[model samples]
Each structure stands twice: as C-alpha cells, then as structure tokens.
Target: MRESLGDFAIGRLDAEEAATVQAHLDGCADCRAELAEVSSVLGPLSTVDAARLGDAPVPSPDLGDRIVAAARAEGRAAERGRSTPRRLTLAAAAAVALLVGGAGGYAAGAYDGIPREPVAVQAMEPGVEVSAVAIPHTWGVEIVLDGDGFASGATYRMVVESKDGREVGAGEFIGTGESKMVCNMNSSVLRGDAEGFKVVDTSGATVLRGDLTAT
Candidate 1:
C-alpha cells in the first residue's frame, strides 16, 4: 500500500491501480497528506519557467490538471509493478513542464506578439543564408539556417552573447542533409540585450559570426 503511494504521486498507476490507490487515499490520512505535499510541489511544474525567464507566454493555467486528466483518460498508465521513486517523479515533472511549455507554444504558432520579420545575419558560406527572429514573451529566438556547406549529421551549435559579455548556448541541431534547419533558441542572452551570435562546428571552431544588433 505504501509503495502504491509513490506510483499514485506521479500518476503512474493504471485505472484499476488508481482506483485502489484512491480508495486507500480516502482512508489513510498520512498518505493523503503526503500526496497533497507532492502535488503542491509538482502541480505548478508547467508554469514555473515562463514566470521566471523572459516574458514568454505561459501554458493554460489548467495545464497540469489537464495532463493528469489526460493520463487518466487513457485508461492505462505505466506499469503498476514498478513504482516511480520520489526523485524520479520530480525529474519527470520537470521534463513534462518543459515539453508542455515549448511544444505547445510552437505548435500553436503563438508568436503573434513576437516579431515575425527576421533580422538577417550575414551568411558566411555562399548559398548559406541565416536569419534570426525573436519570439516575444517566450524570450526565444528562432534561427533558420539554410543553403549549402552543412555536413550531413554534423551538429552545429549556435551560441549567443549578451551585451554584457555573457555567453549562452542558444540552440543546437544536427544537419539533416536537406540544406535547411530551423531551431528555437531559448536563453537569457537572446531574451536580454543580445550582442551577437556565433555558429560553431563540432570541434568548437567558430564557423560564422554576426552581430545580431546590426541591421
């Protein structure tokens, strides 16, 4: 019964197991107290970052509840034989929070408040064009890399530097061999007064550098 508490805390119990846990929760005051404690900490997991970083738009207020409800509606949860440990539960909560935040906003195209017109950065390689567009509220910048010179399966890292000399990892993506890659950059550097950007190869050599503040 106590082990069930962990699974229930993280929403990992199946419908039958969940019913059993609910029945126990209805009677065991200690378990119920612990459950409330866990929820209080994890429930707001989805909205914490948006409130802290930049002015990014937050997900629906009911997002955490909705996620739990959706899991219940699935009728099948993760196996009941394995109870998620408390630490793992917390990590999962954070992961869910991030996924719900970025994927939701990106899928909804909720960049209306942000600038759509891209500020073109000088391209280093011939036929290689790069542009950066700031997504307001979310404090993210969308970087679009296109054209040739990108090696297939090569990972390119885009680093942003703030006006204050602080450098931040803006985004990273692998070349798809299609000559185009679009990535979302979420960092304090881009959110703050960004100074410039540098595209580095796997060996950390700066392949391209451009002043983002320049027209």
Candidate 2:
C-alpha cells in the first residue's frame, strides 16, 4: 500500500487500486500524513511543461548521489515502520533533484530565452500593490501574480482580455491581505491574443489591472 501512495498522489493508479488506497488512507492517520507530504511536493509539478524538461540544466553528479542517499534513508525509515512511503520517497527525491537542477527556475519564467512580458499592474484601490509577468506556454499563457495588501479572506477572479474585447476567466483565489500572495493563473487564450489581465472582486469591480498590450 505504501508503494502505491506515490502513484495515488499523481493519479497514476487504476481506479480499483486508487479506491483501495483511499480506503486505507481513511483509516490510517500515518498514511494520511504521508500522503499530505507527497501531495505538497508533487502539486507544483503538475503545472510544469513536460516537453521543456529536456532543456533544464542537469544536476551535478554529487547532487545525484545526494538524492540517492536521501531516498535510501527514506526507505530505511519505512522499514522501521515510519510513515514515509517508499514510492513517494523516491518521487519526492526526483522532484527535488529536478527543481535544484534549474527546472524550478524555468517553471518560474527565469530562463533568459523564454519570453516573459512584464505586466504593469495598476491598483485601482489605495491599499493594494501587485505585480505580474506573462509567460507563454504551448497550451496557453501563465500569468504570475505577486502582491501584498489585498483584503483578507476576500475572493478575487483573474480575467484575461483580448485586443478585440473578448474576456476569459483565468482563475480565482482567496486573498490573505498582507502575507505576500503569489499566484499562477492560466488562460487558454494565447499570449499574443491577450491584451491585458484584470483582478476583479466578487461584485465585478476591477481592483487591479495589468496592461499586456502596452508591454
């Protein structure tokens, strides 16, 4: 069952196997904890573009050895009845290695070759400060928002607009006020077609606007 936790977290297991794991997790606190850890590590990987992975810088041999060492330690811990799952341990180790090897930077639009358009964010209200970048992907565009000073517990929607006035909902998230929020919203509209992005409150009031066309 522990070997299947990694697959379960990534949705790779068949329905029957997943159901069994779900049942086990429901009754086992230790397994639930392990699953949570695995999910935290793997969650960000879901948004990664697999095709661009080959372009990521390779890790040094020492880094590879360290990853292997960490995986072995996790396996030993599992043998001692610890909560760490063997498969999940390996998956987490691989994720760490990839991130450390520079894939993480690529995912964040840090690659020089990748075209990242800076969005000029204007806060409509007095208390909010926001900044963003638009990164184009094969599937669509990824809008990375970094900001502080939003109303706590308030929900905001990101809208992507085209030059012709067509609007598309990128995504939505709850605000945490001054905690320095970082969000990645994706839209099916291509970056070239997108004219700007707007952060709107539930009442349909635009609180923040970023003009991509000007950039």
Candidate 3:
C-alpha cells in the first residue's frame, strides 16, 4: 500500500508523520484523491490541519471478524480459480484501513458525513470504474462504490450495514470533479458470520446490496 500520507488531510497520526506526507500531497493529485477518498468515507477531513495529526481512528465493532470470514470465503473460492490481483487490492485496502484505525476514529460522519438528503446512486462504470473484484486468500472485507458525471467537488456519503445490524463503514465520498465514488471497506465484522452487506444514505435507504465478495 502507499505508506506516504502526502495527500491525507485528516487522520489519527502524529505531527512528524502527517507533515512528511502533507508536503508530498501539495504536489500529487493521486494522493489528493486518496486523501479525498478517505475523507469521503469519513467526513470534512479538510478540517484537519497539521496541528492535530496523531490520533487513533476508532474501528467499528466486529469489523475484524467480518473481514476474516469474508477472507476465508474468498480463499476457498479462489482455490477454484487464481486471482492474485484481487488479493493484492484487498491487501492494500486492509493495510490502509488498519493504518487509519491506528491513528483515526471510526468516525465516518466527522469528515464526509452526508446531509439528510436522499442519495441517488449511479451505476458502477465498467473498465474505467473501480471494482472490488475476486480475492485470492482474501482475509478481509471491502465495500466499494464508483460512478460518473458529477457537479465537481461533490461529496457522497455511505452507511453500510451487515445483515446482523452492525454498521460496517459509515463514510462519505469526495467527488473527483465528477459525481462518482469508491468506498472500499475492510472492517471488524468480517471475521465470523455475516449474511451480506448493504449501502445506504443518511436517511437510511438502501443503495446497493449483495453478499461479501472475495476481494
């Protein structure tokens, strides 16, 4: 995973580390997008200055269990067919989430928390869009969302829930001069049993629903 927090704006890390990365971000758009992605799922992370940099993010309850179970399922499925790319993507995602939790809070709404307005989800574009594909030896869980055509600098929000009534990743998305987002979650509830995952808006409406995939 990209260990450089060059673009990360708000997080639970200390000053020295945050500064090193922020300096890099001032010139990297990719990092800016990443920082945006993190804030999108979290909240107005821009509110985070270099002053308050070192704080641990609170991971939602049972996220690890949910992730492990999903990973096992993906491993079994991958045994039937190889998918190294998917596994790698998940590894990166898992590592990133772990890092975020180490310093930030599981406080999604704090940064990108959406308004009370209902969400209108666009379809996930193929080829150009990001998708959480099949995972090989997948030992974690993820929630991904993406779309196109937006009003620029738009912020999208998501409230995910496993069938067990536990919130997975309650976050928002900052659009990339367009109306699309991708929130990949590898949470605590994935270690054991979970029926499925569903995405929602601030009003508690369903946007997407399906079983946990391999990657």
Q: By TM-score, who's the top model here?
A: 2
Worst 10 residues of 3 by lDDT: 109-118
Off by over 4 Å in 2: 1-109
In angstroms, the error of model 1 at 109 is 12
lDDT ranking, high to low: 2, 1, 3
Cα deviation of 131, candidate 3, in Å:
4.3
lDDT: worst 10-residue window of model 1: 105-114
Task: Please give, for residues 90-188, the per-residue lDDT of candidate 1 as tens digits.
Answer: 898898768855664333223434444344466564545555554433454544343345567888888888788877887787755546555665555
Taking all chains together, each candidate's TM-score versus the true structure is 0.43, 0.52, 0.29
Model 3: CA > 4 A from native: 1-131, 134-140, 149-154, 176-182, 213-215
Error of 2 at 142 (Å): 0.8
Counted clashes in each candidate structure = 3, 0, 44
Expressed as tens digits, the lDDT of each residue in 1-215 for candidate 2 is 77788999989999999999999998665578789999998968888989998896878869988999999999997788745576688899898767745554423444545566677889998789877889877577889887787799999999999888889999999988889877889998877688998999999999999888963
CA RMSD per model (angstroms): 20.5, 20.3, 22.3
Please identify which of the two predictions, 1 or 3, would achieve the higher TM-score against the true structure: 1
The candidate maximizing lDDT is 2
